[model samples]
Target: MKLRNWLTLVFAAALLAGCGSPGPPVDPAPVGDVQRPTPAGTDMSGQVDNSGPAAPECNPRASLRPDDTIRPGSTMDDIVKRGYLIAGVDQSTNLWGFRDPHTGELQGFDIDVATEIAKDLFDTDDPPIRFRAINSGQREEVLKNGEVDIVVRTYSITCERMQEVAFSTVYFEAAQRVLVREKSGIQGIADLGGKRVCAAENSTSVDNLTEADPQPAPVQAANWTDCHVLLQQGQVDAVSTDNTILAGMAAEDPSTRVVGPPLSEELYGVGIPQQNEDMVRFVNASLEGVRQDVWRARYAHWGLGEVLGNMSPPRPVYR
Candidate 1:
């Protein structure tokens, strides 16, 4: 049978089987054999002598302004009044914010960004940044309700999303991609026509796959981990998501690999509720700090060198 016909039959059968039950969660294969790098410890206490006079402290809260106010208008006031910066993030995405088995603390690229922002606010460079776990669908709501001062999840900047929240300058550029078994013989998105594919629910992956020319039937899982499980079980032919995410999945399971170049460009940004100009400015400055320092170091430490490359030393793009 043609691949298309087979996919259609499977999708029809899936619909008959009911389409709303949540799929089982998929965990990445253990990092047992992979020689993962060790995380860089918090050691900024006395290491400054080697780097010369460090850059002027960007923390503005320490000094009082000419008008006798705390640096004119600042988000510091809001944060101080609230007592803590509530950050919304995903704890399930490995290399982004998955919980560490030993400490039970969330760790990833996004988590590092959040910690930097908090450090600037507290002027400690190691302040305690509080994180609130949020799913993809709840990011907007959490920001709108003031449940979180900022969202550092892998949120893409899109026209529709801009209406609900303001976005910082692009911090990381990623692309939609496909992952398949090493011997699956699938080359790219074009070959997914007759194959079953999976992606996280409420993610751009599903939308992009749904709009493909061949229109593959997408299995929406609660998370990419779940989607990976479906692929391993031979229930799906491909898993679609950001190339960075697929890379993480492949790192966990050498039997699977990401195939083909990126399908579409995606720029990640920090999200804040719309009209909060103060919050937006604070976040932009904090992101600038991240781009300048610690960004590359974190990627290297986290084993993301293969995907991010030299993009780590971020060039400033102020708007």
Candidate 2:
């Protein structure tokens, strides 16, 4: 099957099969055979660093002017003229961006955000929108190369990333946490000092996990579902990333649970090309509208309210 078509079937089958009932305990060990990199300590803190060199780092917020611009001759106009919004997103993060296995349809919270963006851009929720499934590593490339109009994946806004592209105001907030089997005896991230851990390639979790004081031997995968497979197969001791992603993993594997507290604050933003400041403002305006009610309905529709609690959406700020 093609990559996109295979994604939903592969993940849904794996998770559903693995989560049916309790499984045997796992004995995690140091993963020495996997290709890995050195730790960067606390330097790659995954937060926006304003103290860096004097360059135009991306502002965490979009223009807060009550009257924002999304007029003709802008990027928004270009997209409108094109008659469709090409979005880069994930297809296997479950509640965040997974495809529904049963229905073979794309659906998730991030997917909903894309739908909303399309709805506002073309004045109809049925607006032509296409989804391209990209992994953590492809988030920046897709936008930089003009492969997509915007990226709504669980992309964190960082100073380093800001140097490469632009971001709208935060639409959602997440925290990095740990996911381990129920009987893994792992209580938190601190306990994974010498154990092998899995994180998505080119992701903040990789640097964060590697930077642990004692440090975990890192295993890289293309998606959280890959990490989920490794943990299920007892190939890795733990997996770490945003709690939202981990929550999906935990839901898939009944024997696994999200352990440990938050590792870092992650703000999810709509990634636009550096030249599309107008598009950024338009997306920010759309986000403001969604914050009023769309997010609540989305959260409920995905049944994510229980795992994430009552989220009121992130407040908007200007650069």
Candidate 3:
């Protein structure tokens, strides 16, 4: 048999073998064609429409100056009065913001950051906060529609996004990279031409992968974990995203490894609504304390130091 055909047969066999025990005795002959299950809201077409209003010509990292005190009648005050802060977050991106399977609770670097904001707003170490699970594409939509007061799901600060939402100062800095199977023979973005690379829909990873010189075909999944799944199933040639996120996926799967040099620098910021400038300032102020006091502890607690290295919190930049 041809190598391609042999690989395909092996892939199909592995899928069938992992589908739990045989439900009942069956005849030797099987039904027609069995298809692979595509994740919900997955887009295999490599086309991504990025058309929109041009972003303002300002430093994306330069945010509103931080104020130590929250003003009366401000967005922060409203959140305080409401008893709990609503934070939009990702429940799948392992280390950044994922649900702990053991405790059935949300915890990660992003969750810790959001908790710091709530603590500052409510003036308590243990603050009342509700985490609303959202996917990559829904981060801006939830903030715009008031579904969540803030989004901390590894949200990168970009000029184009500034038109749609407000952002806090940079809290974490990550670099874009590639993840591939151990023997995939793919070294970096340079080796990806004509191959399938998967990323979450509307994520910076998709945009960066689409713009590579020898671009691969883009496969959009609902989340990064889904991208990891696609890679394991032999559906995609590689997964491309921030090294911070790729580290999480790599930790979960031992057969994969991250390769290539950094493609781009991604500065992460908290996502807030465009109209809520007060809240943005409040978050920035809260981040000032977080960077100094909480960031290192949370990073160590999550064991990110082993994979991501010991890095200081990103220094704040004010407009």
Candidate 3 residues 1-319, lDDT tens each? 9999999999999999999786888669767887788788889887887775667687988999988677788888888888999999989888988888999899889998999999999999899999999999998899889999999999999988988899999999999999999899889989999899998898888888878989899999999998998999998999999999998988889899999998899999999999998888889989999988988888888788777787999889898
TM-score of each: 0.74, 0.80, 0.88
The best-first sequence of candidates by lDDT reads: 3, 2, 1
Q: What ranges in model 3 sit over 4 Å off?
A: 1-33
Q: For model 2, how does the per-residue alpha-carbon lDDT over 109-143 read when each residue is reduced to its tens digit?
A: 99999889899889985889999999898999999
- The per-residue C-alpha lDDT of model 3 at residue 34 equals 75
Question: What are the RMSD figures for all models against the true structure?
Answer: 20.6, 17.0, 13.7
**Best TM-score among the predictions, by candidate number:** 3
Indicate the TM-score of model 1. Answer: 0.74
- Measured by lDDT, the strongest candidate is 3
Report, for every candidate in turn, its global Cα lDDT versus the true structure.
Answer: 0.74, 0.82, 0.90
Model 2 ranges off by over 4 Å: 1-69
lDDT, candidate 1, residue 86?
Answer: 85
Q: Which pairs of residues collide in candidate 1?
A: none
| Comparison by TM-score, 1 against 3, better one | 3
Q: Which 10-residue window of candidate 3 scores lowest in summed lDDT? A: 49-58
